[model samples]
Target: MPLDLNKLDHLIAVAEEGSLTRAAARLHLSQQALSTSVRTLEREVGVRLLERTSGGVTLLPSGAALVEDARVLRGVAQSALRRARRIGRGEREMLRIGHTPAVTGGEVSLLLRHVAVTDPELAADAHQRYPGELTAGLLAGDLDLGLCRGMSPAHGLARAVLGEHRISIGVAADHPLAGRESVALADLSEQTLVVWGRPGDSGYTDLLVGHCRAAGFEPRLERSTLQGTPPVTHVIGTDRVAFLTEPPGAAAGGAVRVLALQPPVFVPLHALYAPHLASTNRDAFLDAAQARASRHA
Candidate 1:
């Protein structure tokens, strides 16, 4: 039998939220309506789909199978919708793009503008994801290109290394480091450093720590892994300092200050994509992006 898409989505939502009321709220439906839908679906399937108690609703054995099936169905539905849209627009290549957290706000907005102006017919959708996600996306054929930092491209994907984007110390306006044109890793030796990560990637974190050690001082990490741009904001708001991206103008508020690393540390930014991407119109996309970033920088 053909699957009931509506019921499948609702069931998955209910299982995830653990309460019909909350699931209904998430799905933007009345609790009564959601309950009625679930009941109707149970009757059609001729089995109890859930075991509900004050604790929360858990899927029954049969319901668990249905929920797994629902997840597959959701993926299929999303793929179908994307395919239909592409076909309708007569776009040949569905350019799925992913970028690192490094490319955000002004950088992304600017590149998108240039992409649209240069190739409006190109079916392009870009997402900001972690470095690992970008590698996976390119390998899975879901993404045409990724802008990432440090990480090498996955096999079958070639990389064009762009200039490194430096990681600088962002401090509160009144902090001591704010007065310096550039602060070396050694300068932060005794300071309480708000480094990013819980069990953060050693690859990037070690770079920072190593720099300090080389300068004959060790960094005392105050916080583990601060993802994206939050480290910049977090340091400015709370402690004396933190590690952050070097995009000076993107500092969250006027209260923040960017202190260049005294010895200067820069993170590698690479344009990664399928090996074949260099040949086609996709190569033009990179050229445009490079030009845009150059103009702004």
Candidate 2:
């Protein structure tokens, strides 16, 4: 015969509270009803799962062992119930999307607009985080989808490139190459290159180094954190140049100039998510983001 999980839950409640009276009150059932349920479960399991005392009750060794297993089953049952309820009201279901600084522009707004039109029943919420945080959130169930630049080989996450941006050089306005329309990759051989990202991120670092090496010289690489315009600050004060997709604060009086690189190198923006838990909303949003990105590219 199949075991009744509700009875198992009652048993767990009784064992945890150490009193049938209290368990009955907590479960909103009469004391007699709760007792009968426990008795039925004990008989079904063929052992006394609880020891009665004047003050309360305690679990027998058998009961103690079964309590842990029962808790697991009860948790699973509760989770299933919650998911079912959410599915029943599908229009209110929410998908949590996360992104790094790289994806906080028109592309995401366009994706949300598309979802509003195409998948009206689904709602999406967005959060901003660093690339490393985005990946961690995606794997840990904190985020349903993430827009980031790199992947973790260890996690083996499923990802797609949303779009690629051509990398350009950022230099102080007074720098020699800053006045030029575009600069050759070989010209950067003599200038120090600054790159900024999260502490452990090596994707952009590798891209910068590889491009430089391909141009017949290794770049003099410098690193910076994604703090308040530190990469721009470093470039403005000295001869160092930085690789940038846009001027960090050009509109706000930052004296940095963004120059296109000849024979352009591209950096890809990626969408990382768990394949096992993929949903229709996620797939649709990804498709919209890809289309928007292509238009910008």
Candidate 3:
């Protein structure tokens, strides 16, 4: 049965204080009002929860059991109210965010720092997923926003192109192409291309294929899992060239080199959300993300 927590609290106070007059004074209610509240609760629960004596009041067996259960329920109700108030004050409770492999740590950290400054009570969490999985999470309501590259066309989701980043090729430092300051699409025509086929990322894959085919020869495709630090491993050990952004740096331990693509292929970074789930906090995050992307771009 649904319980009225206010009445439950009054009952607990009266039981603890052992006197109607004292309980009423502590609760800021008159004795008559306190008596009415107790009687009403008893009617609703179909049990006489208190035994009144000349000296004070005491709990019956059912009253003792209800008091114990009410203590737990009261705590839960208070916590729920606190969270609700925090939410009303502006994204100060919990914010769920999803990101793709391409979303850099710097980008996510920027947003986290902004939220900490603006709403210190906000607790932000990040879930790392492939571009496809991020998109799916946003649509399924598992995530409030997504940092991703390309996504399939869906009317249920709204996406903004946060910024465009220059595309580069990742190769072993010893590879011939790695020695060049910059390499054109034509330069990679004869080399094996390593690309991971992330689920729901067909649009991005198609773009890569179209760009390579335009250079006159089909790419020799080699696939691998792009999760975690696998990209560094693939570029370091393989003869195939992997595409990257801004190129590999010291994180590759000098084993990898990032060469700019001639003519400069620029890929768009996206911020995706469901229009129905939009909020001031979400919009603020999008604005900050876009600004950061511009700085990096």
lDDT against the true structure, each candidate: 0.69, 0.72, 0.73
| Candidate 1 error regions (>4 Å) | 1-89, 92-95, 110-124, 197-202, 222-229, 247-250, 276-281, 287-297
The CA lDDT at 292 in model 3 is 66
- Pick by lDDT: which candidate is best? 3
What's each prediction's TM-score? 0.56, 0.60, 0.60
lDDT of 2 by residue, 69-150 (tens): 6654554455456457778877455678886655545446666786576566768888777666776566545566887555
Instruction: Give model 3's clash tally.
Output: 0
* Ten residues in sequence with the least summed lDDT for candidate 3: 198-207
What is the total number of backbone clashes in candidate 1? 7
Question: Candidate 1 vs candidate 2: which has greater TM-score?
Answer: 2
Query: How well is each residue in 1-297 modelled by candidate 3, as lDDT tens digits?
Result: 677888998998998899999999999999999999999999999989999999999999989988866755654455456556767887453567887666665657766785466455556688777766775566555677787666653546778887776788888888877767888898887887776663335556666777788877778776665555545456786687887774534437788888878887877777788665534557777776667666776
Cα lDDT for residue 89, candidate 2: 77
Residue range with the least summed lDDT across 10 consecutive positions in model 2: 245-254
Error (Å) of candidate 3 at residue 2 is: 24
What TM-score does candidate 3 get on C-alpha atoms?
Answer: 0.60
Error of 1 at 177 (Å): 2.7
Candidate 1 residue 116 Cα shift, in angstroms, is 7.5
